[model samples]
Target: MQIQDLPYPDPGVPDAHSGPRFLWWLGRNQLGGQLKSLAWGLLHFTSVTGLPFCVGFAIQAVVDRSGARLALSGGLLALCGMLIALGDTFLHRAAVTNWITAAARVQQLLARKTAQLGSALTRRVAAGEIVAVSTGDVEKIGWFVEAVSRFTAAALSVVFVCVALVVYQPALGIVVAVGVPILALAVLPLLPRATRRADFQREKAGRATELASDTVAGLRVLRGIGGEELFLDRYRAASQEVRHAAVRSARMWALISGIQVLLPGLLLITVVWYGVGLARDDRITIGELVTVYSAVMLLSYPLRHFEEIAMAYSFSRPSAKRAARVLSLERATDTAGSLDASVPSGDMHDPATGLLVPAGRLTAVVCGDPDAAGRLAERLGGHAAEEASSDTSVRLGGVPLDELPLDSARTAVLVQDKDPVLLSGTLRELLDVPGSGDITPEEALAAAQCGDVLEALIQGSLDAADPMDARITERGRSLSGGQRQRLALARSLITDPEVLVLDEPTSAVDSHTEARIADGIRSLREGRTTVVFTSSPLLLDLADRVVLVHEGEVAAVGAHRELVHGEPRYRAVVTRETDEEAAASLGEVLDGGVVEGGLRDGVRDGGAAKHDPPKKDSHQSHGSKHGKPTLSDVLNELEEIEETA
Candidate 1:
């Protein structure tokens, strides 16, 4: 592929066994690009090495005092210069292309891994470290990949120059050729110390970067706690350590550079000393002597590629290792599960919690503890905890959800957490996710009560754009909390999954909108199984059945009205009514009024002074059939301790 066709269609599964292995894999995959760079690099360096020969030929022509030879030699010199310029230009372009493509491929791989792992990736790895790997480490790896090909070309050119010189003037060419390799390899001893110092410096700098990031992220907290100056002091100390380490690292590289210059200068002196003796004895001419000296000077430039390659390897090794570690990560949910247990079409059961949600019904679960609700929702969707494999809790159609492949399980169950994120995109793109296509976009939007959201999106645009085409910023930060919630709900509704789990789907909206949303959810998903974890009375009253989860397990299951009168814990969770408040209230509900103690001061029971039950089914949502007053009369507002569940 060409350089422009970057971000490979498939980044391919990596070796990921070790840092070196990962780096090698990257190199092998990009061999085509590397070879392109190598070809251009050969042209550039070979032309450069041939320049000394052109200079030697021109000098001989001038010494001969022949105009024809002088003109011909000058022409050759200019042609060689032209070739050097053309080669250098293309070589650099090709090398930089290699660098960019390598980085893009690595980024794509990391992104795919993150998508596969979902939220589990963040739990297993530090977010800052992940960012550092994608940013700085990726660049380091690309640098090494691009550097390798150039180093190879430079080495090859040096070999050519060595052979040419030895054949041209064996007496003096041998010394210069042998000395060139010595100068190139002379820095090998210093490289270990230099690499160690560089690693130390990088470590210190990374600490400094992380410290600054943490301090800034928590700056508001630090200021509130009156510890801003303390953090500033700590940051200053980290900065100083980084500076010291950088200076130490720079000093080691400077020593290597000094040796490079000094040794080559000594070799030059030796060649000149011997060349002068030969010329005085008329054994070799001035032009040959100049060629030998100039060739050494030209070879010195490419020789630096050796040190550069070594340094590049030292730095990129650790970066490759970090990338491999992230790529190799596997969540417990990512297992080779049974293909036969693919799509769920029956009742969903959680044996561990004793909760069975009948298919084709809306089941509302009232769990007082937010953590328990979250865990249950994830389990219902066939997701495992970040640290370990999930237990045999949830099953679909009598088959364990975990026993099904992740893709099949995810396709079967869609779980929208309390805080559903709205990614940056047009409404059309956002809703264009995997779905059965049974629900239209307009139907989903209406069911989600997003008319006002659609209006805001259109109005917020600079032009009179279509509502579906209007863009939402990242995470919908530009929209209100309720607007984001409704938008996310609409997208989920559009998917129309086999089974859906929504945790506090309407927490951010007002009471009237929440009621409408409840009705919308009921109508929109008439035949699909949906489990809503919420404390809202409006939604609970509309569920086909209400399941009360207490202490992380199902405590009671019944119609909304039955649970309200029969279970005190259920009343406490949904009505926000405390046990003390219940103790101070009138006795057991009696046909609308308190039976023994009579009605509490203002309590009116849907004016029901007679017993009534659902005409066809007593266990059905009493709120839907018995009217709101029977349940609303005793209902109280739940404590708003958590903004979301």
Candidate 2:
């Protein structure tokens, strides 16, 4: 593939069994580019080596004082200069092309893997590692790939020069050849130490990158909690650690460089000392001495490639391995069985939890454990978590979900995660997701109750009130939490899938706004399969059926109102209360009052309420023996603290 035709039509699956194998795979894929680079490199170095020969011949012509010979030598020198200029220019072009194409191919493979595995990939790999791989690691891999042909050509040129020297002067050539090998191989013994130091530097750098990424992601939260300086100090220490490791690595490399210069200088001195003796004895001409000396100087250039190749391999090997590991990951539900290609219009069932989402109904799942609910939501959409059992499965229309291809499964069932990402783009572009049809941006925005979101977008930009063309910053960071969440919901609703699974879609919104969204979703997806995972009362009340998951099992299935009255487990989980609290709150709940104790006086509907001051005996200590605070318990404590303040 040409460099311009980047992101290959099918970048093809990578051979990720090992780092070396992956490097081999990259070379094989871009053989054409490599060959072009090789040809240019050979031409460039050949011309460079010829320059010393031309100078030697020119000197001979001047000594003879022959006009014809001088003219011939000058012509040859000009030809060599032209070749050198042309070769240098083209060689650089070819080498850079190889670098860009190789990097692009690896990036394409990574992009495909990311899309194939989705959030599952992040669970298996650190986000920082992925970031490092895509940025710095890619360049190192490309550097090695681009260096291969140039190094080969440089070695070949050195060999050619040595052969020419031996043919020109036997005794001088012998001394020079022996010293060149020693100069190149003398540093090999020290490389292992250098590689170890380099590896440590890379590790520390990765840690620093991860720390910086986390700090940036949580900057808003850190500022709120007055912990920005704490994290900044930690990062400063990490940065210092990286610096120290890099300095250690650089010290080893500097030593290697010093040895390289010392050995070559000694070899050059020895060649000149011997050549000068040969000249005095009339065994070699002055022209021959100059040529031998020039050839030795030229050999130093190729010797540097040995060190470069070593350093490149040291850094790139681990990088390729990380990329390979990411590419090798497969979804837990990915199976080799033939896909059930026939699309079906029937109920979706989760055999593990015995929860069924009947066709043409809105279902809500309630669980005390938010983590469990999130896992169930994934399974419901045919995405098996890494930790989930392989034997456990979900089915749609009597066909096993694992039997269906990924694209088909996604088309049939779409899952909207709790923290859905709103990629940077215009509002219209964000809503214009893949496979979205018929539903206009306005329709989705309406269904998601996104009027306030549109207002926010309009106010942030110079665009018209339509807000479709308003730009969203990366991850929609400029928008409030509720605005981002609503925009994500709108994007999901626009897809109009056969089955929609949402996890806590309204968690960030107020109850009044959430009620509107629930109503809008019910109206828009009136006859579709919609499964919402949430414990919010507004959304639960809107579901056609509410399934209560207790202790990782389905404890009850009924209307939200019916379950509250019939099943104490359901009530306790929903209200986040103890069994005793749930029983005692029944009367107040029946009277339409809040589940927690009465609000402070004059607190209106949905208004924040102050908490009562805690008694010394009521204070919950860090070493308290009770279980971790439930959602209800946390909210109550927050209120109590607010009142005390």
TM-score versus the correct structure, for each prediction: 0.85, 0.88
User: Positional deviation of 193 in candidate 2, in angstroms?
Assistant: 1.7
- Per-residue lDDT for 19-119 in model 1, tens only? 89999999999999899999999989999999888888778888988788878878888888898899899999989998998899899999988877766
Off by over 4 Å in 1: 204-244, 336-342, 350-355, 386-394, 398-406, 548-556, 562-572, 575-645
Mark the regions of model 2 whose C-alpha exceeds 4 Å error after superposition: 223-230, 340-344, 387-390, 436-438, 587-645
Q: Encode model 2's per-residue lDDT on 1-645: one tens digit a residue.
A: 666787688888789999889999998888988888888878888888887777777787888787888788799889988988888898899889888888888898898888877777777888878888888889988988988888888888878887888788889988877777788789999999998988888888888887888788789899989999999999999999999998998999999989988998998999999999999999988778887887788777777888888888888887887788888888776763476555556898887888888999999999888889887887887777776654577888877676677777778889999889888989988987865476777888898999988888889898566699899999999987778888999888888888889998877765557768999999988898999998766677789999998877888998876776678787776655677866654543335443334542212111112231221111132321111223344345545656686
In candidate 2, which residue pairs get closer than 3 Å at backbone N, Cα or C atoms, i.e. clash?
A: 611-639, 611-640, 611-643
Clash count for candidate 1 is 0
For each candidate, the alpha-carbon lDDT, in order, equals 0.80, 0.79
Give the 10-residue window scoring lowest on summed lDDT in candidate 2. 600-609
Candidate number with greatest TM-score: 2
Candidate 2 global CA lDDT score: 0.79
